[model samples]
Target: MMMSRCDAEEDPSQTKKRKLCPSSGLPEEMVLSCLARVSRSEQASLSLVSKRHRSLLTTPELYKFRTLLGCTENLIHLCLHIPPDPNPRWFTLSLKPLDRRLVPVRSYFYQPLDAASMVAHGCGIYVMGGRIGGRASSSVMFLDCRFHTWSTLPSMGVPRYSAASGVVDGKIYILGGWADIVV
Candidate 1:
């Protein structure tokens, strides 16, 4: 028996037709724009859709959203060297978001602080005083966002942790409960 052209194109075992492209469900441009507006975490998931979708999501335009979220081009800088004994060396890292081409910034050995916190405002990242090896500190470091340089600033009144910082007017306000209490 001879198979007809239509019969040859159709699979006898498969009743469903294969989709040419999932993109037909949504306009490519629209989908790209929507993905750009979402968070990096969300965009990461969208990139898994297919090779085409992943390509669209990796564009420079879409990747710029990471910088726009928490940092601007002018508000990013590199830091080298921390403080307080131990490993005192300078390191470079950007607080800004990054694209696939760009690498995440590294942290410098600022102080022998067990852990530190950072706040970005007015094109600068204000690192409030932290505990050095579990000891309270009064040292503060500021990075000039535009220049990518580091400098020391006035210390916080007290060493703190789990602290929050923000910009009010032109000043950085550090507010939070201290890790240690003095009786």
Candidate 2:
């Protein structure tokens, strides 16, 4: 049974409160609802609290609540071309209590700086249409903010990476990053 304050046998004269959290014996749904109010950066740290916390932090349900509650923050992710490195480096603007700064998001994926056409939609950054090895890249990469995971969507039949791209009406539009088309 999920524990609640009412479930506890309280001494009438005693005034003490018990800590209730996902790891502290609260119902999984309740814990997720509470945690959803917190920011993603803090949520990253909260995952270290325990095994239960770590698991709960990665659930899509938490983010769904966050979206419904309008608690989601705008995440600014930038990819800059730093010479000497073949691929660009990715960094995200981290918002913390009273202190805001850009924090590097360590990505394991290799995205070509020149050929990749990227766009930010909802909680994911879609990196698509790039030149992998001097050839058109058809791989569409998705980065989920909830868990900072890199996943692939269905591959496109043609390379569509370009400087001009956007997400309109939930659809991704790419123009000009074709291997054969030099712009």
Per-model TM-score, in order, reads: 0.42, 0.63
Candidate 1 lDDT tens digits, 34-130: 6656644344456667877766655654445435544233222333344564543333343445632222232333432444567777656777766
RMSD in angstroms, all models? 16.6, 6.7
lDDT of 1 at 63: 47
Give stretches of model 1 more than 4 Å off.
Answer: 1-99, 102-112
Q: lDDT (CA) for every model shown? A: 0.54, 0.71
Per-residue lDDT value at 62 in model 1? 45
- Candidate 2 has an lDDT of 0.71
**Residue 4 CA displacement from its true place in model 1, Å:** 74
**Candidate 2, residue 168: lDDT:** 84
lDDT score for residue 7 of model 2? 75
Task: Give candidate 2 regions above 4 Å deviation.
Answer: 1-26, 50-52, 67-70, 80-89, 94-97, 104-114, 160-163, 167-170, 178-183
